[model samples]
Target: MRYSSITDRLADLGSEKWALHIRARQMQASGTDVIQLTIGEPDMPTDPLLIAEAQRAMNAGRYRYSNGRGEPSVVNALTARYTRRRADVTAENVLCFPGTQTALFAVMLGLVEAGDGVLVGDPLYATYDGVIQSTGAHRVTVPLKPEHGFHMQAADLEKAITPKCRVLLLNTPHNPTGAVLTADEIKAIGDICRKHDLWIVCDEVYEELIFNGPFASPFDDPELAERTVVVSSISKSHAAPGFRSGWAVGPVEFASRLLPVSETMLFGVQPFIADMTAYALTHDIGTSAAMRTSYKTRADLIVEGLSNVPGIVPLPPEAGMFTLIDVAGTGLTGEAFAWMLLEQEHVAVMPGSSFGVEAASFVRVSLTVPDTVIQEACARITKLAIRLLTPKERRA
Candidate 1:
């Protein structure tokens, strides 16, 4: 039986990282009560305006084959949106895709190849390894420390860069840890990339989910414009995940070069979806604002609920929909704690190790759940921590 090498590269990189989540779903399928906080599917529904736009387009029979570049209206909307951030952004710089994941895949394919190294922050998003590997490029991790609030430091990026490195895969308002890069941080990292001649591929899927300060990215800097490519989607910002609408905004040349790569993967996103996306981008549908408040509140709840718990310390996130809780004081690795929590407490959360080495002793709880569920999950998590760290003699 012949199989592509990509299958091997992705063999251990796939569902294994999601084992805890999968197990949680299985338990719930069996009628078990589980407060699952593993994945970051937005709790909010898609805005009615966006849905109506999709419906209108579909009724008008906008369901036709679209060019690899994207539908013109959607492209224009993206251009206008990004141009506001960086005045030079135009239709030529936009390439629409199904989601951030797909846009990243195309960007990787266009930027690196076999024997190349991708400099990424440790404790990166789970699928990043697979994405890099699928392109036959190896991932080189730069440790992101807790003292830095998990933001990738320029010094770390400089130390991790090698002659073989071709790209810096970055995520801000980052997944798992939710650390948003400051403007200065972005410039510093961009400077390193400039010195090393590496392309900056940033995933900004959570751009609008910020709670601390304004969002920042290399793409926003005119100096880094040529080398920076930002991929984002409405999945999080607009609570429109099911629509599968996303895109890559980079230099016009990068978009031109990546066109074939994108076409090879997907001819183009559904045109009707593009119309919905355009509307989502241009209109203030209130989804991101609502989500920002909700997720921020939930993050606060997780920290407030577990901060003084016996053996767990919840790290507050600056942005994004997940909070990391360090379980090292409980004498358990994140993997062990997550499984035990699911089994003993009927609460499911992702083990931090699922992301990367730096997060090994932490568990990531999604803030996408209802407030009551978060409170209950925190209570149960506290109970488990107390039981684990308490003296056996005290537990009659």
Candidate 2:
């Protein structure tokens, strides 16, 4: 039997991260008590109000098919939800999906083709390459510098765009590095993409989790908003990932642009999920706000621990649940460093290479675990750092 190429592309999705880490998971499953921090999932409880809303929807028999777009009120709630950050948005501009990851994949299928060029940031979200590759597009990575706090540089992004570049994938409060793009940085990207006539796929799933300041969107401007496709969800925000709810918003021409392929992705998202999602979007969504506070505290604790460890060069993670600190100074390769920590310390963290090509010297540690777990993990990591460091290396 012959298998299609699309199936091959889809199969490689996130395999890199999991391929090497499966042994650790197996060890964990065998009663090793591994504190897994490899993924971005929050460890908090789902918003009770949102859960109750889902129950109400299920009770009301919202179990059938949706209008093939999404429930109207859900769409409207998403429209109004973004009002504070970007005032120009309305219900007409929104699209709903089971999650942001799928919505993002739709953008690729809709606007990109086998030979098209799609620019992604370096040290990117690992899934970006897999998803874009699934679209049969060329993935052009624009590397971000460490000294600059992984902030997207204007010139690098501008230089990366070519005539065939039709998509610009942007993520603020980025993963692995936890770097957020400033307004100027976002504007620089938006301006260039618009000038080049490219579709900007902005993943704002972490928009509501900013620790230091307000989140900015490319949709802040009318021109960019017109060309921009916004993907967001409750996974990171409301801690309701099990609900499997998220949405997309853009020009309907762009939003509905991939409905054909999306229908193939999964027959429209569940209606009860959509209804509860609508309630959460319209409701207070206070859980997201409260989680942000806890996240900020954890970030501080992690940074503090890493800072005191000899030969560990750490930076503050102002957003997201993780930090990318250079572990090269300890004389261990990224792969060896991560294995040593997991095997010796029994604390599971991601190797920097899981994120991007130039990440071999760094390791990403997630802060989603409880305070005690984080503190204990920090102790083991610090011991590993000290053990790995030579007297000569520690001097640096």
Candidate 3:
């Protein structure tokens, strides 16, 4: 049997991060003390209230397929949350999915056609490149510079826009880099997208994980609300990745168009999970606040520790669960550094090249690990850097 061209394409998009994670797990199983900083999932436990809500729903035998759009309860809860954040959003604008990745794939397939250009930030979430490629769309890269806090500038967007560019995929409190867009930057980028008549997919899965300052959404600008589709999930915020629940909020017409695509792909999210996610969103679980505080402390510790290490420049992450450390000073490519670290110190991290070429000199370290574990990992990294940076003859 032969597979379709799309299936063949999917093979090339295999995630380097997950591959490293798997290798680390295998090593750990074999008695290796591997400190994992590869995957982005929160190490925090899921909120007990959310767990109770789901268990209660299941116990009531509410396991039937939900409405294709979403359970009314979940949609209403999302609408209310968005309404508080942006007054323009209503129930009609919300569509639920099993996960943000699926929501992103559905939106790309629904809106983009073959050969259409999708402008995305370089060093973005690695999975996005695969999503764009699988949709038969071209990915137009706009490099995010460390000097700019790794945020995309409007000028760069304008320069990257071509006649074929039909969409702009934006990730705030971005993956790998932890660069959160400011209100002014969001509005400016929105203006650029509006000028080019590009559809905007704003991945705000890390919306609740902000540290340095307040978060600004593209939807904050009323004019962009109609053009922007906000993709978010309970995975990062509520520490509920196992639930696989997320949502897309946009214009009613857009939601209507995306509904069939979502239905065809997932049929509908599990009813019990939807009910629990609704409860999680509506009720105060105190989980997000706690995760935020914990991650901030972790990020600060890692940053300070790495700063003191020779040949490593750790960028202080403003938000999200990871930080990109420039390892060029060690005279090693990101991939080589990651491999060496794993082999020498048993610390598994993602190579920056996995994100994009622009980050080839860096490696991303996850902040999801415990403080003690992070400290140990930093110590190992410091030792490795010192060893690598020292003159061979002098060390001998």
Candidate 4:
């Protein structure tokens, strides 16, 4: 038996990235005192209002097959949300999907193909390379340097562009690094995209998790609106990951063009979920602000706890629920450090190499855990780092 080329293309995408996380879960299941901080799932529970909305819709018989576009409730809610940022947005500009991952998949499939390129920042979201590969497009990475606070540089984007590049995939409040682009930075990057005629596909699932300042996107710029597609969901914002409700907002023409691709992949999300999403979007549900504070506090805990520890440097995030700590000073690659930390200290974190080469000497710690877990994890991490340091290195 044989599989399609898509399997071959994604053979080494990111399966190994979860090995430590899986091991951590196995240990935890056996009652090991493991502090697992590898994933970014929100610790907050989904709001009852949203759940009731789904129940109401289901009882009202919304379980029937829906049109490919989306139920009116979600479509309208998305339109109103994006329209406030850009006046030209309309219902036709939005297409609902199961989640940000699926939206990115369909959007990439619609935008690029074999022999094309997707220029994405290194240390990107784990699934991005696979999404690009599924469309037969190769990923061209632009480094998001730690010196730049992990933000993507406009000049770097300009330098990385090639004729084969058709899309610039970005994850703001980025995964692993949690670097958020400022408004001016977005303008500069948008200028480069405008000049090069590249499609901007932004993954903004963490849009509401910003701690430093306002969130900015290429889709917020009127001039680049035609070329920008913003994909987001309630997973992070409303603490509704289980609902799997997300959407893509782009030009009307792009939505019109991508609908069939989306329909082919998934005709429409569950109507009850769409209704729940609508309520989540329109209401002033308090999850985003709450998570923002909680995650920021956890990040600060990591920084404060590890600042004086030998052979480790915690990079506090500007936004999002994870922080990257450079472990190069420990004289170990992130993978080795991560494995040792889990084995010796009973803690688990994602190695930076899992994200990209740029973060090879770093490890990503999730802020999704409670403060106590974060504090304990930091102590364990510090213990491991200090143990790894040679007496000579410690003196220096």
Candidate 3 lDDT tens digits, 245-361: 999999899999888888999888999999999998888888889888888898888888899777899998888899889999999999999989998999999989889999999
lDDT of 1 by residue, 49-97 (tens): 9889999999999999997999998999999999899998889999999
Worst 10 residues of 1 by lDDT: 387-396
Model 4 lDDT per residue over 246-321, tens place: 8999999999999999999889999999999999889999989999999999999999999999889999999998
Off by over 4 Å in 2: 83-88, 391-396
CA lDDT, candidate 4, residue 347: 93
Candidate 4's displacement at residue 334, Å, is 0.6
**CA lDDT, every prediction?**
0.92, 0.80, 0.89, 0.91
User: Model 4, poorest ten-residue lDDT window?
Assistant: 10-19
lDDT (Cα, 0-100) at 82 in candidate 1? 92
Q: Which pairs, if any, clash in model 2?
A: none
Candidate 4, lDDT over the whole model = 0.91
Candidate 3 stretches greater than 4 Å from native: 392-396
Arrange candidates, best lDDT first: 1, 4, 3, 2
Error of 3 at 49 (Å): 0.9
Score residue 272 of candidate 4 by CA lDDT.
Answer: 90
Q: Lowest-lDDT window of 10 residues in candidate 2?
A: 12-21
lDDT of 1 at 182: 93
Query: At residue 369, what lDDT does model 3 achieve?
Result: 89
